[model samples]
Target: MRLAPGRAILTLDLALKLALVVLLLLAVVFPDWEQFEGKAIGTRILTYPLSGLLVPAGWWLFFRGRPYPFAADVVVILPFVIDTAGNAANLYNSIWWWDDANHFVNWGLLTAAFLLVVRPLRLSWWNLLTLGIGFGAATAIAWEVLEYFAFIRNSPELETAYTDTLGDLVLGLCGSTAASGLMAVGYQHRELPARS
Candidate 1:
């Protein structure tokens, strides 16, 4: 099947554009910026818009030539946006389970996106499931390690707790597995012969 952009991609692009405009306006007009307070310029940029852009950026970098479904794009972009926005609003700090929930949902989304990317390969169900879950789990662990080195290591507020890291990894694994199962079922349904 030939790949093409659809309403979903257009809508995602529009939302991203709107986010960019909002970020710019805040940068220009918001004095005593709550989100950026006491944050380094580099960290501020990475935390807000840059962090939010990673999903679409990954799409451009890795999957631009492929034909991805609109739902796949939505699956990837929405949770990451929510996670970034939640972080900006300090929801992670306020709600104890918010971080865990984001980890589960966002990693699930990532796994689904990866499965969609590889759909054209026509891998076996088990292989597809393994790839999706493994990739998502590895990526989740890598992200936690990156966080430890970048923001968590030296911070007085954040600690590199073994339990927390393990919990995040477990949540990521669960999410990835769930997404992989859904992909398998969807593929099975699509493959079934249609009734006349």
Candidate 2:
């Protein structure tokens, strides 16, 4: 049997969310797991579930009784899943470019998700660009702050933290800008909602 497009996307989204939960649980249960050794398990345990719930919560809060945008849900949940999976697989250590790519791609995913969530607002292209980039920049800064406190502050990685943080922030903002530009252009013609 074949699922409808929305159903298929929703299925994928649910799968990613489940993977995220399982990964978190494994990290908690086996703190000695390769990636768990020097990582921020506590912060992840607290935040990952909340991050996973964001799309569902937004749907309930903003579009109750309407079909939640499954594609958007997948987009929003993917970054968290990818991040967790990367850590679980030890890609960040085994692969030199994993961390950099994660920052860039995750920010792009986040900015795209933000655009999709606010589409009902019928905001102008410029407004979308401004808001999306601003949101991405803000989140990147917040993430760096969290990283500093969670691991960098006391870790041997502290020596290179400054350069790494700066690079991550720049890559994240670039990703956000690229996603915002694509989304803005795609929606330029439909900036205003049609009258009934």
Candidate 3:
């Protein structure tokens, strides 16, 4: 059976959040779990529940009155689930490039979600693309800075990794571009109706 759009997102969002709770339980109960090692207390708290929660909270507080959140919102939250799962399953360092993949994909989803939420603007296609790219770049930079201050500064290895920062920014750029293209195609095809 087909579910309503909003119901589907709510279900998926709830399931993912519950999964994170389970992952957090594992992390706390079995500190020796390979995935739990080397994770700072602040980092775990931020990544596991706090940061991961803001998307749904933002949706409920700001966007729930709409017919439903754009599917892109659900897409936006998918990365949190993926990232949390990777960490909980010990895949971050185990599988090389996992972090990089997350950065690329998450930024793309976020960019898309932002555009969808603000689609009422009726901006020119060019302007929308510019907005998405700018938003993605700014977010990536902000995240990198947060990482630096929150956890990276304490670790000598992360402090020296300028290339990773640059790489992440590049990925964000690419992701934003991709999201813009996706939105553009949707608008062009009339899949996304302009508000008002």
Candidate 4:
């Protein structure tokens, strides 16, 4: 099945994701920005950027779009609003790494997403899992590529880069799985009313 075909309107999550992608590309395409910031960029990112910009962005995105009643809107938003933000935090590399915490939480979110989209729509589980995992894996690779290029210019240690990349993939898979589960469970129950 295909996503609803329409102009892709702007979302807060979309904005943050776009910013992260742009930031990585900018640094990779031009590595001098690392020193230009005098390492203060890292501190500023941890202290402010993630909380100030990214959180608001995710909150906006999570509530921006309208999804079907009893659908897995919350589940699908879980990745962008919750898990992906955590990933972005790690990318800044300024604070404690929480991939371990994000790992299973993302999986649960993905599971909810899966239930939301596929289950209610009568789509096959196999197809849902495949597509979700494929998307997550692709993004994971893209994030790694971004990081690798950034480090190439920033002159970070290779081992650190490798670890970061690995962490990204692991979390990506977890998020994907949780989203898929959400699709699986979406609209399956007619038991309760959703929040207004």
Which candidate should be chosen as best, given TM-score against the real structure?
A: 2
Candidate 2 residue lDDT tens string, 1-196: 9998877887898898899999988888888877877788888888888877788899999887777877778888888888888988989889999999999999999999999988888888999999999999999999999999998999999999999999999999999999999999889866566779
Task: For residues 1-196, write the lDDT of model 3, one tens digit per residue.
Answer: 9989677778887776777767667667777776766556446655657645565577677767655554654666666667667888788879888878888888888898888766766776777778888888898899888777776666765755688788988987888788887877667667457689
Error of 4 at 46 (Å): 18
Best by lDDT: 2
lDDT of each: 0.70, 0.89, 0.74, 0.49
* Positional deviation of residue 80's Cα in model 1 after best superposition, in angstroms: 2.6
Residue-wise lDDT of candidate 4 within 54-146, one digit each (tens)? 333443555345443222433444444443344333443444555455554655554554444444345565666666677666656764675
Error of 2 at 107 (Å): 0.2
Positional deviation of 159 in candidate 1, in angstroms?
A: 4.5
lDDT of 2 at 71: 73
Please list all clashing residue pairs in model 1, or write none if there are none: none
RMSD of each: 4.8, 2.9, 3.8, 10.8
Candidate with more favorable, higher lDDT: 1 or 2: 2
**TM-score of each model, in listed order:** 0.75, 0.92, 0.81, 0.43
Query: Which rank order by lDDT, best down to worst?
Result: 2, 3, 1, 4
Error of 3 at 34 (Å): 2.9
